[model samples]
Target: MKKIKYVALLAIVFTILFVTKANAQTWNIGFPDTTKVKAILTGNKLVIEGKGAMKNYPRHKIWKDSVTSVYIKKGVTNIGHHAFYDCRELKTITIPDGVTSIGESAFKNCENLAAVIIPNSVTVIKRNAFERCTSLKAVSIPDNILEIEEYAFYECFSLENVLLGNGLNQIGDCAFRACHNLSSITIPKSTSTIGEIAFRECYNMQNFEVEKGNIKYSSVDGVLFNKKQDTLVAYPNGKEGKYKIPESAVVIGNSAFASSKINAVRIPKTIKTIEGDAFRYCHNLSKLKVPNSVEEIGILPFANCDSLERIKLGSGITEIGMYILSQNENLLKIKIAHKNLKFSSKKGILYNKSRDTLVMYPRGKKGSFMIPENVICIKKGAFEDCQGLTEIVIPENVTTIEAIAFQYDRNLKTVTNRSTTPQKISSEVFSYVNLKNISLFVPSDVVDKYRNTDVWKEFGQIKAIE
Candidate 1:
């Protein structure tokens, strides 16, 4: 009877300890004393009464999943970074009027969070502050807010209406990306700078308006443009059909045509530059021409245009960015005008004028391809997703292979390296490739050296070639 009593006493002690640990995990830090803050969980609602700023929500995952509603009392001065991240069931939050800032990712991935009220005292909305809040239908920024950082409301699919305050000055890149239901935006006159892709992928947006007297930006036919209208910024993703760019546009901003469904685009002669990702994922676009006045083309300008079959470059083009025309599976030819001074092509493959760097290889080109003897560098993403080539031979002069150089070539079975020394390659060059199923053939004298290299050593078979 005495022994049984002792066992029960020990069980009681363990139960008490477990409850203490769980409670400790839910408590927020930064309080001067435990008595200065009071947090009570009643059913699904969490009530936090604190005298000063609260530290970022506890890192413990348990607090995130259990809290359905949070009532932050007026004494709290700040909401720390990632305070309520990934709280799938959190539907409503009351941010008090004294709060001055909302940190990065403060409420990221709160999929069911439907509404929030930003108090007038808040000055900054940091990067990814409300990212992926899929059910949040609307929000209004108070007049005291000074900045809205990158990806602040990214992928908020249900967000339809936004009311911006007059005090805001700067908006960061991708601030409102992929908010499919947002119908329009009006930038306040006090705003001076808006970053690239700030409103990209807002599929329902019919227009973007700048408040009258704004000095840095303007709108032309609902398209965002620089105040002078020399740079063409974002084109609403919802607008479809053939659209000719204005003849006065000198530069195409980053992501200018990203995720657009336009059937055709006519870049005018006045354009001097096409920035990175300018035409990415425009699957319906089939043809493009760079006029003679153009001087540069940025990275991946025409990537993933599935129906794009032909491209022509003008004579004045001097700079071509990496992966400029990658993933256009139907692209059969890329022709450069004869008077071009910076680049050339042989057999439809693009290269620098001196032929020292292989720029990109068309994915639609068939059969085996041999790298020219004079090429020394394979540019980044040069051969990405090129499944048509069953084999490749790298010439002896080639010394470096950049990142993702040969990625996703599932059908590639053999590679012949003519270099006597093992050429170094980036770790991502062969990413997603089944190295054990592919064979690597190296010069007979350097077979062992190639076998010792990091990426080459993983080949299924390393054979000596005379």
Candidate 2:
């Protein structure tokens, strides 16, 4: 039975390939003449050779099981955008020295492509050029290239070796993201700029080397840092156990520790800023203490960390972004020091310094919750995804409830608002909730006001408080 299945699969593969070849018509990039760009199929190989530039290779599904190889001859100056995209069966490609640029997504998702020589004459590799080329094992970037664009080599799971050229100046964001088998990489001395998330999600890279005389970046214990060592750059996802931020480091670059395996981290007091998504998705991190020297905390810094339960904020943190600690299912408390001028908390719930704005309510806080009388505003996503609450009391002073303030509260059945005036709200304030089954209790004088309000009118029962 197994042999028969294998044979059937082979037959299906051949049938698809043959059908593609049957549909093969001469596709010329520009004006079709003897001197212009043209493609022709000879057996399983697609031969593309001409004196001028080819506008584009083909669409994603066009070459799925058909073409096995592509040979761009010496006179072709450019390989246009998405030329060989999603060519699953293509294994070998020969790009001649006359080609000057390989356009965006030129070889994207070519799963069977193993190796290719980019000629020294090529200068630009546009965005997503070799993204998801799973079987690609080795590539030597030519010396004349200047930049490697975003998602250029993203998610090449089996890619093991990459040779960067000395003349290359910039590596774009997420250029080599998630290349798990890549064990090491050497940054050439001439490369001055490496974009954010450039090496993130690379699980197996153990050593990051910066060639001596490189002035902009450096490496310590296989981690990348700025030349002055004040900014913490990329940390290998494969790195294990606890990590301590160096004493000299003041800034943690965005997405620096995202999706990492670290169980604990110690932030030194010298650190001043924790950028957006800096510690995002660190599954093993259970606790964190932001030092008193940190002045700003960016969005979603510790989000999606399933095990994180507690955090102690420094007194100096005056700028805190929205959803900074969102999606932490186990989070129960956030302790803020007294000197923080912009933020404060009541019983582990985050609020602005004056307690006038309810910032975030813990998702794990059980039973009923009450907003303080001083709170005039409920910020966006203040009660988002809080699965524990079944009832809530909005103080009389709260005149505003931001979008999605009570979203995803499946068990919430009652809401008592003391406000006399109809509170302003949008249509999506109670999204993903069964408002028709929930009751709204308002002040006696505001019963009609609550029942007639835009979003409040959808409540199943509206009553006047005694």
Model 1 reaches what TM-score against the true structure? 0.81
**Candidate 1 backbone overlaps, count:** 0
lDDT measured at residue 138 in model 2 versus the true structure, 0 to 100? 87
Candidate 1 residue lDDT tens string, 1-466: 8899999998989888777555643454444554566666655787778787766564445567788998989888888778788878898899989999998888999999998999999999999999999999999999899999999999999999999999999999999999999989999988998988988888888788889999988998888888999999888887888888898799999999898778898889899998999999888888888889888788888898898888888988887765788788888778888788888887778888888998878888777988989999998878888888789999999988999988888889999999998888867998888989999999999999988999999999999985
Predicted candidate 2 versus true structure: per-residue lDDT over 1-466, tens digit per residue: 9999999999999998998878665656642353488777666688777788877645653455688999888888888888888888889999998898888888888999999899999998999999999999888988899999999999999999999999999999999999988888999998999988888888887778899999999998888899999999978787879988899899998999998888899999999999989999898999999989998888889999889988889899876655888888778888888788888977898898988998888777788988889899999888888888899999889989999998888899899999889888997788999999999999988788887889999999999876
Single out the weakest 10-residue window by summed lDDT for candidate 1: 24-33
Model 1 residue 337 lDDT score: 80
